[model samples]
Every structure is written in structure tokens, then in C-alpha cells.
Target: MRTLLQAVLSAMLLALCITATTQANERYIVKFKEGKESAVKAALDAQGAKLALDLPKHNAAAFSLPAQALTGLSHNPNVEYVEQDAKRYLMSQTVPYGIPLVQADQVSDSVTANIKVCIIDSGYDLAHEDLSGNRVEGANDSGTGNWFTDENHHGTHVAGTIAALSNDVGVVGINPHGNLNLYIVKVFNADGWGYSSGLIAALDVCEAAGAKVINMSLGGSIKSRTEDAAFAAAETAGILSIAAAGNDGNSRYSYPASYRSVVSVAAVDENKQHADFSQYNSQVELSGPGVGVLSSVPMGTALVAATSVANHDYLAIAMEGAPTGIASGVLIDCGSGEQQCDAAGKVCLLQRGNISFADKVLACEQGGGVAAIIYNNTAGQLNGTLGTTVTAIPAVGVTADDGAAMLLDVGNDATVAIGPGNYAYFDGTSMATPHVAGVAALVWSHFPLCTNKQIRAALQQTAEDLDTAGRDNYTGFGLVQAKAAADYLALNGCTAGGGNNTCKGKHCR
Candidate 1:
């Protein structure tokens, strides 16, 4: 009898909780009959409903009202069907690094707000602090999973790189002030993987939602006719699609990116050279900062950067194979070993060359070293791959200058610490794609009347020519230049100098 009474009380409590949650707030976008917005507003006013936003172009108004008021709305002679306003959540965070590089700060937020960019990837984490209030209502093409919440951090991170809030606390986006709304189309699952069919569906939805640009950071090696057709249709509808060239670091084609309808973006390092992990091919359209690219990540897991040799701070990239911990010790120079060296319990400092990066780390492990710091023999910070996993210790790469400084430390202890950071660094064409996409939106927002073709041409014409002059496979048309694109649009209008073709000789049709 006691157990039965407790169960009954628990059931009642659950019911109350459910009712409270369901009744909290209800919002809807109500479309009124053509030219009857005033009548709709009057009707809403009679029911004491709150108007959230007025959409004269769509003949619609977003309202917060009770069930009784909603019923009253349907009875109005001028009323059209109402849609329940979808709930959108925040996802990820970002810090400013790529924005100044592209000179996107020259433009204001009000200008960018006119452009709506659709991010077709995993769901967004609506709870992310930096991404608060950046979402707009669009189709959730994730099929079974909820599209508003991002379980996988990839989409959220991409969103941050494109448009993280400009608040001084976190990273500023390319168009940080621009009201460029992000329409998330959850094409991937919780594990950061998706099918081409899902992506195709997302494109259809983005087309209907009036998205100006589509950023696809996910791709597969195989080609699908269904996906290609969908991309072509999106292009026909005047949506600029930008995608990652793939991370294979080869000349092979990666589908969707390889599709002619899309602008296939390749990745470049800080030095404006092709990243070692970035893919290359004739299909490449442009390049953006990919190596050591910093952006937002899921909450709790931080991407910390704190390393010093001989008390002088220097930038370091923590190796993916590195274990989770702080490492500190007297830096011991490990000369090119044709023989085994004594590096027991100390931080082994290895110079680049003499052997592969993996073998050097292996040697450190064999000698019972606590950590391994590999410095570049030439220049720049080393971003080396160990080829395989090592459980012995944490490893990282420092610049040649830091490496030389460590070598000079004959007595002092060289400290290396790895822990949580608000931001993280990632590499690949995936990172570069967002930079181009964000700049595209920034340029598009400035000239909202321009067709997608015009925007694409503006981006291409404005890119800083890299490598060989003109377009090339390695660096595409060169790195994407945001300010130059905007300037071109302002000076040339939509069409270029020749006839009605506003796209600098590129065919619009």
C-alpha cells in the first residue's frame, strides 16, 4: 500500500511537470491574406497577443498567443494558415583570428544581416553561449534527429567560424556585427557523418527557405548522381554552395566538392601555402586559412595553448597523439642518434630530420622520456604526424626559434603545459570552407540584390592571386579576399562592364 501511494504521487508530479513545460510559451508565424496585414494586426490586438516580428514581404507576423487566441485568429476572415515557430538552439563558440585576415571588419553587421546563410551539417547546440540568437527558422533535414541541437560539435564549430557573436568576450566572426542569420540544416547524425541523400534533402529545404549561401563542411569520396542533381538545382535557384575539398592531401576528387555547381574550397596554412593535410585538384576554387585555424568547440573540453622554453613563451601545437596532462622537465638535446641516447624521465628535445617524426617520438618513448618536444629544423612551427599512436607521453611541435632556445638551455628547466582552452586549432579544407563561406555572406549581404552567380564571380575576381598567376589547382584563384570582393560589388554593381553580365565575364545562366 505504501509503495502504491508513492507511485501515484510520482505519476501526478510527472504529469504536472509535463503540463507546465508544454504550456510555457507558444509562438507562431501567421500569414495573413494579401495586403491584409493591418487587419491581422487588429485581430491580434483584440486578443491581447504580442507581435514578435512583422514580415510584410511574406504577408506574415510572428505572434505569441494562447490556444484560445490562436483559435480566434483562424476565425478572422483575413487570416491565412499559421505555423508553429520552430525552436532554435545555440551551438559552439569562436575567437577572432580569421576575420582580420580577410578584412571583414571593414563592413558592419546591419549590412550582413540581409544575407541568410544555410549551414547544412550536424545539428546546432542551441545552448552554446557564443552562438546565442544567431539562428533563424528553416527546414530541419536531419530526418529523425532534432535539428536544433548539435550533439556533434563540428557544425557548431563551423557556425562559429562563420558568425560567432562579436561580443568582446569570445571570438568575433567574419561579419561579427552583421545580422547574417544562420539557417542550420542538420544533414549529419550525432557522429559527424551523413549520407548524400540527406544533404540533397537539405539543399531542397535551403532553397525553399531563401538561403543565399550554403556551407557544406561534410563530404565523402564517392560520387552520387542524386547529390549532384540536387546541387545543380540549388545553383539554378541562385544559392551559392561552398564546400571543403577533402582532407586526403591528394589530387583525387571528393564528391559534392568536386561537383561543378559548388565552389570547392582548399585549405592553406598561415604562410598561405597548401596545408599538408589539405586535398588538391583542378576542381579547387579557392583557399582560406586551414592550418592552426582556431574556432569554437563543444563546452567543457578546452583547447589550451601554454608552452615555454627557457621562460620565453612561444606558440605550440599539441599533437593529436599527445596524452592529457601537463609536462615539465629539464630540456635535453637529443642529437641525431645512430645510437640510443639517455633521456630518462626528462623532456626530450628532438630536432627535425635525421629520421621520421614518428621514429623520434618512438625513441623518446623507448628511453622512458616523460614528454617529447620536436622543433623545426627549417622554419615555422612543426605540425608533424607520428603515423601511429603512442601511449608513452605527450608530444608537441614548436617553432624553429623555440627549438633553438631550448637547445641553448643547458641548466634551466623548459616547461610545457597542456590543458583546457576556450578555443581550439583545427586543420583541413573544412576549416577553409567556412572562411570563404563567411566572406561570401559578408559580400552578399552588402549587395543582397546580386544573384548567386554574381557573388561567386565577385569572390573569384577579388581573390589575391597566389602561386602561379591566375587560377591554379594548388591554391585555386588564390586566397579569398573579403574586402576586395565587397569593393568590386560596390564599384561594379551586380553586372560587370560587358553587357548585362554583372559577374566579371562569368555567365549567369
Candidate 2:
């Protein structure tokens, strides 16, 4: 009886050990010796490893296997090396700096005057706090979902740039007073793409809704004659149409924007420099702030990180994939964060470079850091992302100047807070499109009696010419200026250019 009981206990123990070992699987990339790919794969298969990816060109294969099996695999003559399969992330969006750059802030609140601007892109987030207060309406042509709920954040971001509420918490749009009657026509689905037929149908919806300006921050390489006819008709109907000039950074023409009837908007940086990725062509009509443009995304999908030391708040941007929480501790400098330091129970202040943001944050967390702050090695802001690497501590980025100042105040109590917020930074001519559209609405509201052609002419004439001086392919007539365009119209009546004086009400007072 004693022998039988001992045998049972031994079997139970062995089963538990094997189960634990099998559950401890981790993903890794295993490189094989030249001409030994098949042998290495077979050996890995014998070790109970599951193959994930096969890269014959690089002589590598990704697998998920027991951590204990790594040693034996590395010893195989066919195996070259084994390393962890690291994660990668998309480029993160940043804050909006285009409002004042495009002179939208200089326009008066009365300039809004209930002008209707239609957005045709991904669906809008009707529930967004910054957008919920506005008189917004929409219709869904894409087979995705409802027009009010945005599964993809592109439309919501674009809408915020044109009309986010002037609420103090989140971002404020060009028409910040919530005065414009926004008509959203969701042509693009959650995949960030749509058919040309869907877009033309959306134009019909815009016209029916009585929208005076249509913002099309989307395009394709192929130009459809039917789509061109639709835009031309929309233009003839006195509706101002604005579109992105593509982000290809080439001279190739992008549809809709390339059409004669549409205002093609190119992207420029904060300093009014043409973006390298912004397409340059004779069709480009105007330029606006597009690079690092901060605007509203879906609520809770993004956040703004705030950092402060000794009651001094410094401008900061949250690292992508950072946790939403607050971490406060004594600040400790961890130069480059390449090597571990005495960061235990403190906020680790690391300088950017020499390693990935994830590695730096990992080193801090490994050393028991309560939070992490990475300063730029260069002059501009350090916008870093952690990919899929998650940490227990909060991580934020600051400008080089702020980072330098913080380095001097080491050992001070600092706080890094990232919580629920709705704003994000996005780059592309898609971002520039909204700026021009919003400016058009703002200027048109003041000159309601002016024809669409007249308003278009005023904007082109008043633009701050950039790049190759007067009307070049890069920046066209240059940056769209809200106050300048408004001033030009005020000085010259609607008939100053050519169109008949359609004045009936108070004319450009």
C-alpha cells in the first residue's frame, strides 16, 4: 500500500511540471545556418515548437516554444541564433499647432455665422465631448456602421480640426464656438478606404443637406470621369469643394484634388515650410498646417501627458501605447537609459538616443522606476512610441529645452500624469485639408453674399505666397490666411473681381 501511494504521488508531480513548462512558451526568432533551414525547422518541431513565420530569404523562422528549449536549440549546429520577437508600432499622432499658424485664431466668433461645412471621410464620433455640443448631422454610405460612431479615428480627427468645441479641456477647432452646422457624409469605412462611386453618392448627400463647403480629405490614383463630373456639378452649384493634394511627396496628380473644380490643399509644417511628403503639382491651390497637427480622436482612444516639477508645468506629449495613470516621485537622471541605474522608486529622466524608447522604459521599470520621462537629443520635441512593450510605469516625452531645464532640478518631486483625453496628433495632407476648409467657412460666413468663385478668388489672392514666390506647385498661393482673406473681402466688395454683386443682406460689414 505504501509503494502504490508513492507511485501515485510521483506521477502527479511529473504531470504538473510538464504542464507548467508547456505553458511557459514565448515567441522568438530563430536564425538558421546557410543550407540548414530544413534541419533547423525539424529540430525546432521536435522540441514542441509551433512555427509562426518562415523567412527563407533571411534564413530565419519565428516560433513559439518553451523557454527551457532555447538552450538545446542554440546548441544545434543548424541554428545560428535565437532572439525575442520584438513588437513594432505605427507612427503616433501629436498635438495641433496649426490654429494660430493658419491665423484661424485671429478670426472673430461672429465670423462663424451658421455656415454649413460637409466632411466626407470616415464616420464622425458624435459622442466626443469636444464635438458633442455642436449642431452636427450625418449619413452613412459606407457599409461599415452608423455615421455618428467612428470605428476608425480619421473622420473624428478631421472633424475636430474643422469644428471641435472651444471647451477648455480638449482641443479647440477653427470654428470653436460650435456655431457651424456640420454635415458629415461617411464615404470611407473603418478600413480607411472607399469606392469612387460611394464618394459621388456622398456628394449628393452633401448637396441635399444644403452644405455650402465640402471637405474631401481623401483621394485615389485613378481618376474616374463620373467622379470628375460630380465635383464639377457640385462646384457649378455654388458649393466650395476642398481636397487633399495627396501625401506621396511626388509630382503625380491625385484625383478630385487634381480636378479643375476643387481647391487642392497641400501640407506645410509649423514654420510654413512645405512638407516633404506633400505632393507638389500645378493643381495645388493652397497650403495649410499639416505636420504634427494635434486634433481630437475618439474619446478615451488618446491622451495628453502632463509633467510638472516644483509647481512648474512643462509642455509634454504622451508616448504611444503608454498606460493611463499618474506617477509621482523624486526625479532621478538616467542618462540615455541604456544602462540600469539607481532609479528604484523614483521618476527616471532619460535622454533620447542610443536605444529604443521601449528599451529605455524597460530599463527604468526593471530598476523599479515609478515613471519615465525621455527628453529629445535634438532641438525639437521627442515623440516616441513603445510599440507593443508595456510597462508598469507612466512614460512621457518633452522638448529639448524642457528636458535641459529638468536635468538641472534633479531630486525634485515630479509628476507624470496621463489620463482620459480625446486629442491626438496626425500628419498628412488630410490634416491640411480641414484647415483650408475651415478657413473657407470662416471667410465665407463674413461674406455670405459672395459667390463661391468670388470667395475662391479672394482666398487665392490673399494667401501668404510661399516656396517659389507667386503661385508655385509646392505651396500654390501659399498658406491660407483666415484674417487676411476676410480683410481682403471687407476692403473690396463681392463684385471687385468679376462675379455679380449678389448682395441682399448686410454686405461684409
Q: Positional deviation of 252 in candidate 1, in angstroms?
A: 2.1
Tens-digit lDDT track for model 1 on 1-509?
A: 00000001111111221111112136788989887888778877787788998888788989887667887877888887887775342332334456766767766657666788998877666666567767555446535377667666677678878877776535667766637888888876666676777788788888788788999887889999988988988888888999999888889898798999999998877778887777889999998887766665555344343455666666666665555455666678876533455877677888888787767877887887666788888766566666566655667777788777778884455555444444456666878889999999987776766788878887889898888899998889989988888777777777851225454312221
| Candidate 2: segments with Cα more than 4 A from true spot | 1-97, 109-114, 167-169, 248-252, 340-342, 496-509
The candidate maximizing lDDT is 2
For residue 343, give model 2's deviation from the true position in Å: 3.0
Native-referenced Cα lDDT, model 1? 0.71
Residue-wise C-alpha lDDT for candidate 2, range 274-346, written one tens digit per residue? 9888999999999998877777777766656678766577767777777756666789999999999788778
Q: 169, model 2: CA deviation in Å?
A: 4.7
> Which 10-residue window of candidate 1 scores lowest in summed lDDT?
1-10
